[model samples]
Target: MSITSFSFPTSIRFGAGARKQVAAHLLEQGLKRPLIVTDRALGALPVLAEFRSHLGGLDVAVFAGVFGNPTCSQVMDGAAAYKAHGADCIIGFGGGAALDVAKVVGVAATHEGDILEYVWDHPQVRAISNPLPYFVALPTTSGTGSEVGRSSVVSENDTHLKRVVFSPKILARMVFADPELTLGLPPAVTAATGMDALTHNVESYLSPAYHPLCDGIALEGTRIAAAALHTAVTEPGNLQARSDMMMASMMGAIAFQKDLGAVHSAAHALGAVCDLHHGLTNALMIDTVMAWNYEAVPAKFDELAHVCKVAGGGAAFVPWLKTLKASVGITGTLASHGVKPEHIPRMVEIAVKDICHQTNPRPCTAADFERLFQAAM
Candidate 1:
C-alpha cells in the first residue's frame, strides 16, 4: 500500500450555547468582519435572529441564498457577497449545504481561478492564495464536517456536475457544534441527514486506502448512527440521541475525507440529474452500493459484522445495512427516488467524472457506473 499523510482536525467547541460565543471567538482570533453563509430556510427571521445576536455588531454580514447541493454560481454569488461585505472571515451556519458554500466562498473569494480548476483531478495549474482569512463554523445540523474538511463540494449550475474545491485552507479555524440548534429539524429531515452520515461511515470503512485511522473512525461512526438514528428519527426531542448522531455525522466527514468511493460518486451523479437531496439519495442507494461493495471486500464487511451483528449473528455489512435502512425508513431504491432506467447512461457518465469515483475499491468506467446505476434502480 502507498503511504499518505493524514491530518487530524480543526479546533472545536461542543455542547449547547457554543454558538453564543462566536463573537468572542472571532474577537480573540482578530477577525473583525465575517460572512455568515447559511440556507434560505435558515435565513428566516426567527431562525437567524439569535445567531445574529451572537455576532454582537462585529460587522458581521449575512449571505443565506445557499441552497441544496450548493452550485458553482451560487458559490460565486457567495464569494461576491463576501467581497461586497468586506468580510475577513466566514461563519458557516446551517447544514452541509451551507457549510460547503461558506468554505467555497472563503477559497474563491481569496484565490484567483475558476473554482473547478482546483477540483480534484481537474486540469488547472493554480496555486492557493495567501492565508485565506480564517473560518469558524456553527453547524445547525449533524454535519458533513465541512468544519474540519479541506475541500468543499459544489455542483455546476450549467450542467449540475458536482465538483470539489480541495485545500486545507478551506478548513475552519474553529468549529462550534451546538445540539440545541438542530431541535427544529422535521422528522424526515432528521432521518435523511442521519442516513447521509451512515453512508459516509460505510464508504470510509470500505475505502481502499491503507489508513487504518479512518477505518476505525468510520466503524465507530457507523455504530453510533446505527444505535442512534432510529431514536433520533422517531423521537426528535431526545437530546442524547441527537448529540450522538451529530458527533457521528462529524466523524463520518472525518473518515470519508480519507476517501469516499462509489456510493458518493453515484449519489453525486443521481443528485444532479434527479435534483434530489444528497442525503436522501444516499439513503435510497446505500443498500445497493453496499451489496456491490460486498463482493470487493467481504472480509471488511465481515469486520463490520458487529455493527449489524445483532440482526444476523456474524453477518456481513449487507444484511446489517438492509436491516438498518428499513429500520430508519430508508427502504427505497433509486427508482423510488425518481431515477428512471433511461437516466442510467447520463448519470453513469457524470458519476465517472466525480472525484470520489477514483477512490472506489473497484475502479469504475462509464460502463461500471451504468451497471451500478442499473442495479441501484
Candidate 2:
C-alpha cells in the first residue's frame, strides 16, 4: 500500500494501514508508556484488541469511560488514569468524542484546578501555559476531524451545555488516518458523520472570514464530500471512497480554522439542550438553516452549487442537500429526533451565544434561531 506523509495543520500519515504505524510513531516521539483514550463501545471491539496486540513490549493502558457528547468529568477521570499509569503520552483512538476527551485529558493532566477552569471564555479560567504530553490521534470515523483540531467540545455535567476548550497547544503531534478503521461503521453512522463533514465544509466556505486559503480548501472539501459520501455509505468496504471522505473531512477541519457559521452554532445548541449526536444534529438541521441563510449569501450558494454540481446555482443547492441527505438514508425532522417546542427558547439562547454565530454570513438573532428551530421541527 502507498503511504503519504504531509502536513497542512498537523503531521499526518495517510494510507490503508496507517494505524499500524502507531507504535513506531509513538516510539519516535519517545513515548514509552502511552494511555489510549477511547469510548467504551469501541474499546470492547476486537479491532482495538487486535491493535493492542501489535504493541509488543510497550507499556499501554486504556481509558474507556468516554461517552457520547463527552463531559468534563470524563476528561478528569481520563487524566487521573493517565497519571496513575505513568503515561508519557496520549493516543486518541476512536471517533470525535473519544478524541476530544483525550485532547482535554492531555492538558488537564498537567494543569491545576478543575478542568472547567480552563474552558474557553471563562473569566476565572487560567490560560493553558504548560505544554502537554504528546498526542497521537487515530480516527475511526471520517468526520469531526477532532484528531487534527485544536479544540475539544465538552459538555457541562450539570446543564449538559456544550463548552469548548480552545488552545493552539492542544493540536495533535501526529495523526494516523487509516480508512480501514472506518469500514466497520454502520450505514446510519457513516451517513450522519459524512453529512457532518459536508456541513463543516459548507459552513466554513460560507463564513465571511477573509481567508482565501481556507476558502479554496473549503470549496474542494465540499466537492470531495459531495462526490464520495454516498459511495462510502453504500459500499462500506470501498477503501477509495472512504479515503476520499477522510481527506475531505480533514480538509474541512483545517478550513474551519477560518471560522464556521450558524449551522454549527445551531448544532452545538442541539447537542447541548437535546443531548443529540453532534454530527447527526448538524445533518438534521442543515437544510432548514441553509435555506434561511441562502438569501444572506446567495453568491456563496451559487458557487457551492457549481462545486456540488447542481444546476441553477443558489436556488438548487438546498434541494441538492435534501437529495444528498435522503440518498444517504438521513431522513428526519427535529421533533422526530426528540426536540420539542418548549425546548426552542433555551436552544435559541444557547445558539446565539455560540462563537460560531459570530462568523455567520448574515448575523443571527435569538428570534431568528427560534424561527429556524421551529422550521426544523
Candidate 3:
C-alpha cells in the first residue's frame, strides 16, 4: 500500500448567525476590500443582501458571473472582477459552482496564463507558490461541501470537459457554516443536494483506501445525512435538519481526502457530457453503481446498512438507497433526466479516465461504465 497523509485543518464556525461574524473577522485581519463571488441568482436574492448588510464597514464588490456548472471562463471573469475592484480578499457565497469558481479566481488573478493551465493534469501545470488573497466561504446549499474543499472543479468553456486544480493553497481560510443561509432552498434542490452529500459519504466509505480515520468520518457522515436528508428536503425551515445536513456535507468533503469511487467518476462524466447538475447525476447513478459494487465489499455494505438503519444488512443497502431517492422525489433514471443513449459512450470514456474510480472497491472498466450508464438509464 502507498503511504497516505491525512488533514482536517480548515477553521469552521458552524451554527446559525455565523455569517454575521465574517465582516468583523475580515476587518480584524485588515482586509477591507473584498470581492463576493457567487451565482447570479443568489446575488439577486435576499440572502446575499442580508450577508452584505453584515459587512457594512468593508468595501465589497459583487461578481455574480458564476452560474450552472462552473467553467474556466467564469474564473477568468471573476479574476478580472477582483482586479477591477482592487479586492484584497474573496468571500465565496452560494453553492458548489460559485464556491469552486471562487477558489480558483485568486489563482488566475495572481498567476500568468489562462486558469486552465493550472489544472493538476496539465502538461505544464503551473505551481501556486505566490500567496493567494485571503478567502472565506459561506455555503447557501448543503451540498458538495466546497466550503472546506482544497480543490476546485471547473470545466472548459467550449468542451464542457471538467478539469481540477487540486492544491491546499486554495482551501478557504475560514468557513462560516450557517444553516440559516440554507433555509430558503426549494425542496427539489434540497433533495438533490442532500443526495450529493450522502453520495460523497457513501462513496468515500466504500473506496478501497487504507485510511481508517477517513472511513470513520465517512461512516458517521453517512449516518448524519441518512438521518436528516429527508426532513431537510420536506421541511425546508427545519434548522436542526439543515444543520445536520450541513455538517454531513462538510464531513463528506473532509473524508473524501482518502478518495472517492465510481459514483463520483460517473457523476463527473454526466456533468461534463450531459451538462447535468452534479448532485442530480450522483442521485441518479448512486444506487445503480452501488448495486454492482455490493458483491466486492459486502462487509462495508453491511456497515453502511447498519449506519443507515437498513434491515437485512448488506443485501438491503442498495434497496434502501432506491427508497431514499424516491422518498426525496428524485424518482427516475438518467434518461428521464435528459441523458440520451448516445451520451453513454462519451460518458463512459470520461468516467473511465476520471481519477476518482481508481479507488473504487470494485474495479471499473470502460465496459463496466457503459453498463452502469445504461442500467442507470
Candidate 4:
C-alpha cells in the first residue's frame, strides 16, 4: 500500500480547570444547545451534575443511556436524543464508549440509514456524505484516546462484533484534557485504561506501515505510559501522573493514525465475542500477542525496551509488561475474563478479519490467532 498524507486536527486544552473552559469555547463557536453524550454511570454521578452547571446558559440535554460497548441501537438512540433536543453541537463527556457514541450520533442524526450501514468495509455500508455537528470531547479517563480519534468503534447488534466507522468529519473540533476529571476513577479502571494507552503506542510502533511521525509519537507515548501508569493507578489524585497518562493516551491515538497491530485485533475480538471492556481486553492480551510477534520485529522490540526503561530487549519486554500489569492491579487471563475453549474458534475467526492486524509486523493467520488465544488462556 502506498503511504499518503497525515493530519492532526484537534485543538487541545491540556491542564487542570480545562473542563471549566467548555462553555466559553462553545459560545465562541456560536453553539447554544449542546447534547452531552456519556455513559449511564457517569451521567448519574454528582460530577456530571456539577459539570452541567458550567453550561448554565446553554440548553444542554444529557443522553446517558450509552453503556459498556456502544451498540448500533445506542448510536441511533443518541441520534434521536440529538434531534429531540435540537442540539447544535455534541459534547462527548466520558470514556471511549460515550465519545464513540457521540461521534456516530452526529452522522446518524443527519444520515439516511442505520448506523451500521456506515461501518468501514461493511457490505452495505455507505459513504459518510453528511457533515457532522460541531463536536468537543472531554475524556474523564486516561485511556482509549477516543477524544482525538476520527474513528468510532461500535458493536454490531447481530454479530456482536466491533465495527469501526472511520470518517474525518467525526473528528472532535476541540479536546479538553483535564486531569481533574479523571481523579475519581478507581484503581482497576485506571490500570486497565492506562494499559490500553500503552498498547496503542506499542502496537503502532511495531506495525509495518511506513509513517515516521506515528513511529516517533508512539515511542514517546510509550515512555510516558511506562513512567506514569503505575503512579496514576495507585495514587489517583496525583494530577501530574494523571496528566502524563492522559497525554500518553492522546499521543497514542495520534500515533495510531498510521494503524495498530495484532494486539488490537485480538482485543477487538475479545470485546465482541465475550462482551469484555475494550481496554481491559487489550491490557490482558497485549503481552501474549507481543510474545508471538517479537521475532517479527526484534529490533523494534529492543528500541521499545530502551524507551520503556526495561533492562533487556526482545523477549524480556514481555515480562516487563507482565510486571507492570501486576503492579497496577490488572490480573486475570482471557479464560478468567469469560473466554471459554468453545469461544476460541469464533474469536479467531473474528480476529482474522480485523483491519488493525493488516499492519502487524508479522502476518497473523487464523491459526496464529487461535494460538494467541490459547496462550492468553
Question: Which candidate has the highest lDDT of all?
Answer: 3
**What TM-score do all the candidates reach, one by one?**
0.92, 0.98, 0.98, 0.96
Winning model by TM-score: 2
**What is candidate 2's lDDT per residue for 226-296, written digit by digit as tens?**
99999999999999999999988899999999999898999999999888988899999899989998999
Residue 87 in candidate 4, Cα distance off native in Å: 1.1
Residue-level lDDT tens digits of model 3 in 344-367: 999999999999999999999999
Report the candidate with higher lDDT, 2 versus 3. 3
Per-residue lDDT tens digits for candidate 1, residues 1-377, read 11122235777777767788889988987888988899998998566788887778599789989887888888888889999999988889999989988887877788787677667667664667667778888887774656667778888888888777778777887888887788778878888888888888878888898899899999999889889988988888888888888889989999987898888888888888988988887877777777776777777776677774454433455666677768767766788778898888888888887778688777778887787788777
What's the lDDT for residue 131 in model 4? 76
How does model 4 fare in lDDT?
0.90
CA-lDDT, candidates in order: 0.80, 0.91, 0.94, 0.90
Runs of candidate 3 exceeding 4 Å displacement: 1-7
**Location of the lowest summed lDDT over 10 successive residues in candidate 4:** 1-10
Ranking by TM-score: 2, 3, 4, 1
Model 3: worst 10 consecutive residues (lDDT sum)? 1-10
Error of 1 at 354 (Å): 2.5
